[model samples]
Target: MKRAHFIYLLLLWCIPMMGIAQIVPENPSSGALQSVQNLQVSDVPNDAGDEINISWDFPDDLDKSQITEIRIYRSTSASGPFRQIDAFPLVLDSYTDADDDETGHIVTPKDTYYYKIGLFNGSEEVTSQVSEGVSPQISFFNWGRLNVFIILGIYFALILYFIRASRKGREIYIRTLPGLEALEESVGRATEMGKPVLYMPGIDEANNIQTLYSMVILRYVTQLVAEYETPLIVTVGKAFVVPLAEETVRQGYMDAGRPDLYNQDIVRYYSDEQFAAAAGVSGVILREKPATNIYLGSFYAESLILAETGFLTGSIQIAGTGNIHQLPFFVVACDYTLIGEEFYAASAYLSEDPKLLGPLKAADWMKILAVGFIGVGAVLETFGIDLFPRLLQI
Candidate 1:
């Protein structure tokens, strides 16, 4: 028993010594076998100043095959329990250590940090001397974004020019949109048939640009319906759009000298749920069988459902949306469809207000300018003159 106990104690002591031999070099001079030299530390420029870049030179005489791993460590102090920041293949000589955690959450900012590179062979590691301290800083201007600023400035200038010219009473001419022209006919047919006209302001809140444009067209449509003495039904998918739609309809009636004929029930707010709103609107179409169905604004998969239901009701359907995918459905189901930007241009066409017309004219001119650029680019590309492409690069 004594002999067995003595052997067991000897084995435990030998195991720890073996581990120490593998992890730590017996001769300190062996660490010179692989070395990192001329270490550099600098803050990254044109950034929020939360990153430090570290670079060094690997010993040329060292055997590259023997180097299995390289690690980067950072510390706030020279005498440090250096935290391992990253590990990479032996080939890498540089690293960027952002003053953040692994998940990109900021841990330290404006804090001076020191870094060291480690070369590993199996369980053994040789560490280089510490680098000079670095602190991250923010720059006032990032020249990288200068090109974006220039483009935005040009666009805004163009819009302002048109707006000012319009205010000065310069008449801006816009060709009549087919969709706007058909509005009168739709209202007239509804009036003759003595059936109500149904208008859906899309399935979006008032904040949406598409919904705002829809309101602009709604005002005009309401006026036409009031003038024709036809009952109008406005169903909206958002509660926020309800009051806006109601007021627009009321104003239209007032403008047409038919305020007394207006009813609060004419404008209804449906559920915000997409399919639910679609179903509710579809039920309205089937039940009331409106002579005219006008759909304008943002739409999604439910677009086909609403348009198809209106088609089955034999209504003169006029649909418009910015969602391109749903355009095919509307084009097929509706008698007339305002495709993409045509829907936006319809409001300005019908209203002819200088406020709207000026912007419309400016947009058209901008589009012409864009086409010119494309043509120039194509010609240059054909001739192998790459200068134009480089000029466009930021």
Candidate 2:
């Protein structure tokens, strides 16, 4: 099976528990704090057993102005030798202690420990009773990100289902990309004019996502040009991309059953410098005047320079990139453009391979799910109901 890498989702952070305090064990500390009730210690949940959570209550009659700071103390035994772990202002009533404390104190998973709280004035201090035994327990899965994991599971299932269906000859419908549709027209025009086609796979490193997608599209284009026996030129910017582009071009020729037409020098190397590569490639656009010009991959400032130069040469141009900012320039200059994820979907669209098609279809389903979630969340928010938000807090 030809496996394609599934892209990741951007998840937001966990909800903060700033104003929440826990049940009391008893507070004996005082400066002007009469009864600092409910000093409790527990394990920090949904973590790798690396932290302990301590919380205390802010009493109704507490005089905040008279207190200088609140302090936390930790020890292995309840008998003696307790050391100060943290001190913070009167505003906060909770702290999360990590195993990597700067005091060289270490707490292992399932190790019993005791904690104490202290109140301090300008010159005097008072201490609280030690908390009961608390230990950090390692959790394999984070309950905070439970919703994200659930969504991911459903997405994977959809992918697997589609893959099996596709393999069994079930047809999947993916919307057509105009940029891709124009490739045939571009090649046909080049063949008619007896002029070569020029392809630039962006200026960034080959490992970049945009560059990687560009390579896939490049392979498809190479095969098209090979089938028509039209000359193809692949120009690259980064030094590392030279060999990859060469291999892809070679593979494309062989896949089209025209390996004899493959030329090693067809994939040319420019410079690693951004503008320098743009200038060198622009010179080729002017000199060769290729009938079709295709630019795909990660691009920066040089995007407009190359596209504009190709436009001036009156070539049938098609451009695609993941960079949104550069899309405006490509849209203005090129006859057709692949916008954002359209470039990513090219591999599945061109090949129709079951492995790639499954993921592409799964992503579409995920987007539909996302839109539904957003719509429901908005409706609930209008009614002052926070069911969806609270579900994420778990």
Candidate 3:
């Protein structure tokens, strides 16, 4: 009986200690910040439909000194398996949950979502009550792009006004392009010498803007060549350019009322290999001893080779390309070189068609306006006036 009483008392004493061991202590960081209140969610205004704005009142009783960050969470329902959206400092009272392509959010319209803002200190998270459901709706028009819309309207108006004026028989004067002016002289020289005129319409694909511009100039050149009855030899670098160039040459002959003299074999396709085409064109120059060489199109490393060959053959070379790096080669090797917009302007100056001339005149006016604005902006910057530059940013 004595031994049984001693064992029962020891068991009683050990039960209290085991209970104490099982109890977990509360985290001190849990109460570091008071909960956020009055959380608000609304649709973002004047935006594409995949955005929503979130805002909340900062907790009044929070100790900001101890707090590190406030985290945001989003879910489809109030009883959520919530996912973290982002984190912000305690100073921010709002956030925008918009689709960020760079972040791979990939947000879509009309999907309702709930949000929860969590107050965090160290590793502890103390969350606020879930926000009410919010959904994004598509906006009909974006007012933020109003400035761009106005600028485009002004540009179109300028073009239309100039076109209408041009049609009324008002003469538009274009600055002279020496390279374009030499076209007539070169064709005439070839005619007088009884030698062929060699023309190379760049090696780039037809879709390139520079190549397209070259074709436009070529169309005008063909008319002159046909009128002078000068033999024209066009060597192409791409197979796709062959058909378009042939048609352009044929049309030019027809327009000149000398369709019978149009030769289909004149526009020939050379190898697409850059150096091979350059070598072939160089051989043609040496063999035919052409009096004039016109190379207008996109050019790469082969620009200097062709120009040098033509220079050696004593041909009056007129070359035009937008490639800035290759321009110096043409300038040194060719008789006259068309730089930058001069190459584009050649088509308008040569055609003198009101349809083309009007846009050209408006473009010139636009350039003048741009230069004037730049000059004014530079002067205003000295006075700490930033409004002028800011106005042109959009």
Candidate 4:
């Protein structure tokens, strides 16, 4: 009887162990790796370009201890005979393609690449479904003759709509009192005082949207200065923007038919150091005593110092920055400021170019749709009804 009782106790302990093994299955079921969650890609920085980062989370049934290695594969086609490009020892749940120590792959604009990850445990392997093909999207306006017709068609339609709207006398709800208006007055004041008008394109490359927008506004402002035969000085902090700003200013003068009045020396490049650039611009303001100062672009901590110095110099300051934190300082010191999207809209507003205005109007209409949807959703929820609750499920 004693021997039998001991044997029963042993069986009871073993039963729990057996159940544990069954509950935590040693091998995952087929199609266990169905969900590929948290996939993200972003442009890589500080390179000649044409590089992107790809990363994803591991499968749900993934056994961290059993995973010996992870295999990475790449394919040009989505349904592909994927070729193994990289293999990493399972140290973490995620892997970054660009940072891998192995032979790095250089991406080309012409080729679209898809990625697949495989988790290996000795002989057994679980492969992830292939990622969607990723290729560089060519800008519609930049691409050759193939896209020219599409671009022209868009512009033509916008022009026709603007003309029709004008004829119909439609009341467009455009708000008055933009911040850049003060900059215009500042430029006019500088022209009268015989002092230069100073403009700074933010300290970033041409690829930066903020820098591009700054140049666009600069074009319009320079044209005004040219008409007044005023001296306009543009100091850029980035080497790439130097030539672009010069071209923009030169083109503006040419368009004004006063190329002779354009001063090449005024549009210059300064040191790329954030604080040093601020100091240099301060020196320019103090020495040159510019009657009007315009700061439009992506600015950091240096924005306040620049604006404050320009303010002290008795120059009419107009600042526009996409940086949310800097907006406060610009507001406190600058006479007029373009906040966020308003800065981008300046070119469209000044030129009254229909090509730009149509998109702006369309965007406003989309915003109205968004606000209406939000309001309707709130009302529905208050009444304990969900119009599209299934959308929140995934």
Error of 3 at 220 (Å): 1.5
Q: Which TM-score value belongs to model 2?
A: 0.73
| lDDT tens digits, residue span 1-394, model 2 | 1232222111111123222223322343432555356889889888889888888886776667887888888888887588987888756888888877667767678578898888887677777887887889999988889898998899999999988888888888988898888889999999999999999999999779888778888999999999999999999999999999999999999999999999888999989999989999999999999999999899888989998999999998989899999999999988889998888888888888988888888888899988998899999999999998997665
Superior candidate under TM-score, 2 versus 3 = 2
lDDT of 2 at 113: 82
lDDT of 3 by residue, 63-122 (tens): 676668888899988899889989877568888898999989845675789999888877
RMSD of each: 9.1, 18.6, 9.1, 9.5
Prediction-by-prediction clash tally: 1, 1, 0, 1
For model 4, how does the per-residue alpha-carbon lDDT over 1-394 read when each residue is reduced to its tens digit?
A: 9999999999999999998988885665633433345655554443334556677785566446667777878788988989987787854545545523355665666778788777777677777777777764434342334344653565566556764674466545556645755656767788889998899877767888999989999989989998888988998888888889989999999999999987779787878888888888889999998988889999988888989999999988888878888999999988888888788778777877555666566556556756876888889889988873533332
lDDT (0 to 1) per candidate: 0.86, 0.86, 0.86, 0.76
Query: Please, what are the lDDT tens digits per residue for candidate 1 over residues 1-394?
Result: 9999999999999999999889896566545547688899998887877777889997766666767888888888888879887887756878887756567645255578888898887777889999888778787887667766876777778778887888789988777677778999999999999999999989988999999989888888988998899999999999999999989889888988889989989998889999999999999999999999999999998999999999998999999999999999999999999999898888778877777777777788778977988899999899998875676676
The alpha-carbon lDDT assigned to residue 188 of candidate 1 equals 100
In model 2, the worst 10-residue window by lDDT is 6-15
TM-scores for all predictions = 0.73, 0.73, 0.68, 0.61
Q: Number of clashes in model 2?
A: 1
